[model samples]
Target: MKNNFYDQNIHYQFPETFWWGSAASGPQTEGAALIDGRKQSIWDYWYSVEPERFHNRVGPEHTSDFYHRFKEDIKLMKETGHNSFRTSIQWSRLIPDGFGEVNEKAVAFYNSVIDEMLANDIEPFVNLYHFDMPMCMQEKGGWESREVVDGFVNYAETCFRLFGGRVKYWFTFNEPIVPVEAGYLYNLHYPNVTDFKRAATVTHHTIVAHARAVEAFKKLNLAGKIGIILNLTPSYPRSQESGDVAAAHISNLFFNRSFLDPVTKGEYPSDLVELLKERNLLPAVEAGDMEVIRNNPVDLLGVNYYQPRRVKARKEPEPENAPFMPEHLFDPYIMPGRKINPHRGWEICEEVIYDIMVDLRDHYGNIPFFISENGMGVEGEEKFRNEEVVIEDDYRIEFVKEHLKWVHKGIQEGANCLGYHIWTFMDNWSWTNSYKNRYGLVEVDLKNGLKRTIKKSGRWYKQLAVNNGF
Candidate 1:
């Protein structure tokens, strides 16, 4: 009844040329896990043992079935007006055992997926890791062991040699800090060891693995850009008091700058290093490790912005013998009237995205980057279906519009942001959350054979992609 095709894409129009697509990890979307010689990722093993931990008792193996239906999915990508898409080659699927002979079926599957996207004019942005480590690797100390680091390098090298010509954009890891905080500190992920020393060690080895992968890519003179994805939470303080400000700074240093500095600036923040030294928590660094990190920086950066971290100065000294943590330096404080996503409970402060971009521009040399993942999830979205049977997710449309405006502002004020991709392409199985929270333009019906339907937001995204903004 109305012509609103270019309504959102205009006004805050993006650059004439930029990436337009969504991001998905292999474990979340590929369901033929045990079909093609694919071994168990930690999520697989964890789900098998503790299905109660996962929402609805749905496991990683029960996703959108991308493994068997990527061709049709690529057609949907074209319908949604995507020029580029991002996904990972599952480490567990590729190597299956982490450090052993490669699975030829896994290689062929990825090859076909990449080719299918290209055949449909959808460029693929490939990431090496997305929190789905082979269970065998986890059993062998995971990221804490140098052996895993070597295994990671060999895997990366193999990927380069196999798919470098077709895939030009590569990321070493996605959200490396999450596993450190969840598994080691908060005990939210597997091998839940609440040891600060081991967490620090894992963080160091992750950095090493990323740097070595970059080194491998550069040494081969590959034809692609290699980088890492970081879910950057801009730390906000309640007041401008020096103490409160310092607390926020400490939070940022410990979380954001921990991996950001070494990947982009070639080293960790001096203050953080000193703080670790004072705590006797500095990770054991080997000869040439720092050199590798310092010498090899990423060619691109992936920014996954979901929410901001708000903190204030600690009111009292932390209890003695309380295990060491970044939280000990600051206290969580809920801002009085911050906006929030009703379904997900995450605060919706779109301005923080601009804050991160500005900081990167002013402090980190304005590196080429993109908004890799940003979206809102609403529970039970099928209730919104109109007479046409399409899920009318207008709230999602508004959520994306608000964020894109900030992206436009960043681009205007001098942040070298290149693109924006939503958190997902379809409603698929999230690791622990499963499908409880729907964050896709396309809704997947789990009760009915995983039926896929394009929501209203999907059509809007098609227009947004065609218009290159919105």
Candidate 2:
């Protein structure tokens, strides 16, 4: 029944050069967290003190054992028809003390991974940071301190000097705003503080850090593109009413344009800056910080679209003493009978992908970009396995096909979208959520020696890539 969804469909062919692969990170996939001079990261420290905060108390130390199994994993990646893949260099692993001598073991491991991927015809897109800050840097006030920013710049330079020749695409950060919102504002991440002002400071410093990295990349003259990955959640109004429209606009200004404008336009959105300033929530900026940000815009963009943000006007005024939050400006709007991904609690709005592409085409100069991360995460997937032991994830296949249809429409309508990479290649540890929500083309059976098995969707993905589309 599920397979019939693809029958008699209009062929959606992508460009011959479209990238087909997935994204993962060192901390999330690479086990051996405490070996070969790799020191503690914020995740390690957080899990140490507050194990209860993580799902099932499963920490980040021993994830998928990719450190020892990357060869096998890379082979699996090829089996899934990956022409390119994105992963991050662990800051804690590279420079265990946050700044100083390079860890030779770490260097060797990364060199091997890059070489192996190249050998397999996989273009490696290396990212510098993925929310895995070195513990030593966090102790120095994380992104709130200039010194740590400088350290990150040095680390970026080191990575460029070492692996720049092979890596033609580099990213400064993955979802840079997540640390600010999760760690500083929402208390969902490490050092969970709930202060808007501090969050604002972290946000500023992170941009500075990213720009500095971009500056470093430019100086090195590496023959590659440098960019950042943003999990873009397009904001939608509950109704066309003026109040709801205003609320949605405000939400977009705060969440989307705050980082999007700065990186792409090389300046923070004027409206966002004024809003922060009027509320006395703007962070202190150094004299040259804006200059750096304005000068070093990204060369490409990676959009991770999981859900759309639906907002409406606040139903009531905030309490006089209540602390500020993004929600204070808007209220969440739950549309009746909206499709949702139950495991992740996110709306499954396939058209939003096209909306994002149209937005880029009309407003963002049609920047060269790709679907850096998009996939479905289902809990307890073993229930869907067949007698062959392969998980028949028809829902996942439908999910990708639906999104790709919109993506193809956007391209046909003149959006500068390049390629698509799923959220991940295989199941691995996902921060505090652990392995609870699996979002992988390949299954990692934790109960069976971390074995790898391609799901039914993965088999279809190979043909999708071979044909360039479905």
lDDT of 2 by residue, 92-153 (tens): 99999999999999999999999999999999999999999999999999998899999999
Task: TM-score for candidate 1, please give it.
Answer: 0.98
What TM-scores do the predictions have? 0.98, 0.98
N/CA/C clash count, model 2:
0
**Model 2, CA-based lDDT:** 0.93
Q: In model 1, what is the error at residue 1, expressed in angstroms?
A: 21
What's each prediction's clash count? 0, 0
User: How much does each candidate deviate from the true structure in C-alpha RMSD?
Assistant: 1.9, 2.7
Backbone clash pairs for candidate 1 read: none
Task: Report the Cα lDDT for residue 233, model 2.
Answer: 94
Clashing pairs in 2: none
Model 2 ranges with Cα > 4 A deviation: 1-10
